[model samples]
Each structure stands twice: as structure tokens, then as C-alpha cells.
Target: MSRHPRLAAVAIATAALAVLAAGPVSAGEPTVSDPRIVAHFDFDAGQTPENIALEPDGSADLTFAFAHQVARVTRAGATTVLATLPAVANPQTPNIGAAITTGIARAHDGTLYVGYATGTAENGIWRIAPDGGAPEQIAQLPADAFPNGLALDERCGTLYTADSARGVVWRVPLDGDAPAVWATGAALRPTAALPFGANGLKIHDGAVWVSNTARGTLLRVPFAEDRTAGPIETRATGLEGVDDFAFTGHGDTVLAALNTPNKLELVRHDGTHKTVLTAADGLDNPTSVAVRAKTVHVPSAAYFDTTAPDPNLLLARISRNKL
Candidate 1:
């Protein structure tokens, strides 16, 4: 999702700690009440945590392309490797150069859908059986078309992919069919397709909410029925390098990872937005955010030195009294 300008700059500087302190804290900043560090994983020894997917069983699956493996971190804090991806089919082509899995989602049937960008021309979708088998490529995307984000509409059995290169949203039917362009345009292409760009996505109610990193905007498009809608409705803007987001337990409140300042933001579905946490709140290069129960889990990745220590990705519990 490097298309966004703001995120491109952040990606260049992997020192997540430095970026978070670049700005000052203000009273208007999003309030993170009773924030505490619930869990911490040190990637300094080479466990680069990329994206996180939570299972119904309360286990957190952390994916890392550096290790070509997915680690299951149980709610009890024990970590285990769930699976390892195979080498790219072709190593010479830029499209299929390296097998870098970026996004992941689990279907209602327990099928795991993983999206990866082969350094070569071959980027596509893959499915891993619930019982755990080899990942099978389901669809091959176009050359230079990197699939960066994945969101599943379980009710409709539809999968959405954010094609950062083409600045388009793609829909793939779970029943196995050709993928179609669900949405496209310059507005969709917030930046060049870098971090925090169009990297976060989710389908809620009858619409798709996308985080526009370059413009620092969150966009909402009408559901499948309004696939041909003229333009997306701007839900919120002025955010700083907004990356991935997850809905709160109530589904109406959202917590977003702000990449630039390394903060977590809380956005109300009704259009109210606030910075809930800042550098003081202990987030570093907060790339993705997910909420389970009352806990907001954030994953901070250090992009510069793959060997540098990854920050203690915080899991803050939302105060029941505040909301």
C-alpha cells in the first residue's frame, strides 16, 4: 500500500520511535483513557510481525514475510508457528520475485485467505485449508498489480482486495470465478501505494470503508448493490497516515493505526474522530489495529533495520465508563 505520499516517507524511515515523537500532543488529540500494555513481542531477534488476524478461539495469528511463516500467539501468550509458505514458483520475474504475504483473513468456514506480492509479476490470492495444508493459489493477478489488503463479507461470500497499483478494489467470489473491479478512480489511489496508503479495509453494514493514507481520509462506498455509485462518501479526513482499522465491539466505533505519528485513533461511525493514543501512549510505527472484546491490539513494525527491535505492540482495554 505504498501509493500514499505520507506513508512513503514513513516507510523510508524505519525508526518507528523517532516518527512518533515528531509531533506535539494537544488537548484536541484523541484521548486514550486507562491505556496499558497488555502484550509485547520483541521482533529484534528476527520475528518481524507484519499483519495480525484474530481467530474465534481467541488466538492471534501473526504473519511475517521475513520468516515466511505465520505464528499463532495464543491468548495465554504462548507462540507457535501455524504454517510456512513455500518459495515463489519463479524467482527471476519481478512479479514473482519473492513470496511476501501481506494481508490475511479467515472465512466463516474457517478457510484462511492470504494475499501476497511475489517480487515478480505474479501476485494473487491463496487459500489455506482449515486443517492446515499447502497454500494453493486461487487467482493470479496482473503484473505490477499488488494485492495489499483483504476483507471478507462473510454474509455475501465475497472477498475484497485493494489493488494498490491500479488504484482499484477487486471482488473475488468464494465459489471460484473471475475477479471483477468493484471500485476505482484517483480518489481511491491516495498515494503511490506505500504503507498507510490504501492498506486498511473492511466491509460493514452495506458499505466498504477504506483508509486513504496519502490524503489521510477514510472513505465509505455503498455496498454491493451500489457498486456503480458515482463516488465514495468521505467519512472522515485530516488523519495522519491512517493505516489499518478495526471496529470496536459495538461495531459503531473504530480504532485506526496512524502510521506517521505512531498513534491509535478512535473514530466514531457517526463521523466523530479523535486521537486516542500518541507517542506517550507507547505505539511505534503502528501499522495495524484490531479490537477484540474491549481490547484494542496494535502491531508496530520497524521497517528500517529488519533486525531492530519492534515496539511493544500495545493492547489497550477500552474503559467501559468512558463510552
Candidate 2:
């Protein structure tokens, strides 16, 4: 999340301006150059790519928002459609009118878990089979609950999610009952509603690392500690719209996606930070990031544009050593 609370305010105002502006500007074909940017593939014009989950075998599982699609992209960059979401059953559904994939994670056994928000009235978790099967709802939340980011503790078979609407992190057992609040506070609330907005989440080394979108900082919450501990400490600041992140190698380093500036940042546990790549680096509206084998991969999708070209989805590759 961008540490500046004013960015969210500006975003809200910009959203209104965007609506008034109407049509979207044409974006050119994405290209990669010296900095090691690799434009893997593009999605359908209206498909808004969100989070990306890498398969153990090197393929990628991608989520699309307005297009209502989840696709599997092979290491060769071939995209295979997995599923399409159905319309909401209720009329008064909060954010349920549209099914958007806000979070995605893979379990130890290879099953995929996706978190989505619909119409504002319904939010829930869905399980996807590795071999490609229908997504099944495993848990559901109230109208006001909007689940955003997801992470899995493969060793313990536990899943963690940042419930932005409710201002809490929920812990869900893979095969057990529904999820419960594992952490909560004003700091984790949505950007529009809190001084600090919680957008990205990752569980590493027994601690939860969260991106405070509004406050423009990375916060750490020790496992099993009370909220009074005040999120251990802030990781980094001065970032513009840090939304989602991923750990490299053994979790010693992090790669974050900056939404507003459309950049990717590399942050070390020691507090050192550097902009690895930016919009100038060929990324536009990058919402989430993932790293594998020292290679930083980011998904660029038009989040606010309703009529942007569908194939605008791009997977950008950056060398980790450059960071």
C-alpha cells in the first residue's frame, strides 16, 4: 500500500474523474528491454488480471476480475481457461454483483484457494482442483466482509486472508471448520475507511507481514501475539500504492507491486528498499507480484478501466539480482 493516506483520497477522487472522462486511452503492445522485462502473454481485452499463483511445475494460475475467468498459463506462456464465475443469486448483494478474484494461494497438496468479493453483500473462499475442476465454495462471509489477499502455511495446512472490509486477518483450516479472526485492528481496515489500509498479506517465519496501503508502510505482526503489540514494526515506507507482495528464495527478501506508480519494489528484511521496475519498465497498473528462482514476475491489468483492451494483461519478468 502506498504509505500516503492522501493517495487513497486521490484515488477515490480520481475514480470519480475517470468515470466522468468515460472512454479509456489506448495502451500499446507491451515490450521488455535491457532491465530484463519479459512480456509473457496478454489476456482478453476486458479481462482484468489480479493475483498469480505459480504451480510447483513452473506453470502459472492467473485470476481475472471483470472477465470472470481463472486461467492456467504454462511455462511456455500458453493460457488455458479454467473456469468462469456465475452471476450472483441475490439482488441486494453487497459487492456480489461482480465476482472478482482478489486473492489466490496454493495448498501443499496442490489445490488452489481463491478469495473473491461480490456485489459488496457476499464474499467467500473457493477451492480449485489442480487437475481443473469446478470451484467449490468452502466458506462464506456477510455482506460487509470483503476478503482480499490470501497466503498459505503449507507446513500446517493453514490459510490466512486479509479481510479488508472487516479489518481482520482470518485463519482457515484446510479441512476443518470455517475460518476465524486471527488478527485485527484499525491498521488493517480498508484504505477508504482507515488511516492505514491493509491490502497485501504474507505469512513467513511465523510472522504475518502486511502492506499498510494508506499509511505507506509494511507492518509485521508476531504470530499468536495480541494486537496491542502494535504490529512489531514497520518494514519500509515512501512507496506509492504498495498492494501485494511475494517472498524470494527463503523469505529473506520481498518483491512488492506498487499500484499507483505501476512499479515493482524489492525490499530486504533489513529495511533496504529499491525500485526494481516501474511503469517506465513496461508495467501498467500492476496489482500483485510473485517471485520464483530469483525471478520477479508481475501481472499488469487495467483495474479501473472498464473498456480497456482485453489483452492488456501482461506478465513482466525482472531479474532478482538487479534489485
Q: Give the candidate number with the greatest lDDT.
A: 1
Going through the candidates in the order shown, the clash numbers are: 26, 24
Model 2 steric clash total: 24
Model 1, C-alpha of 20: deviation from truth (Å): 13
TM-score of each: 0.80, 0.78
Error of 1 at 304 (Å): 4.4
Residue 101 in model 2: lDDT: 70
Candidate 2 displacement at residue 59 in angstroms: 1.5
What is the per-residue lDDT of model 1 for residues 2-68, given as tens digits with 9 covering 90 to 100?
Answer: 1211123555433322122223333333334666554566553335465678888767776664455
Off by over 4 Å in 2: 1-45, 89-97, 119-122, 191-196, 225-232, 305-323
Q: Write the per-residue lDDT of candidate 2 for residues 1-323, one digit (tens) a residue.
A: 11211123434432221110112211221122244333333444335667888877767777776555777776555677887655566523232344567788987677888886774434678888867677877877666666677888877677888765566778877776877787777656655423326668888776888876665567777775432223556767665567788876544567788766666776666555666676666676677877666345677764532343222334444443322
Maximum-TM-score candidate: 1
What TM-score does prediction 1 earn? 0.80
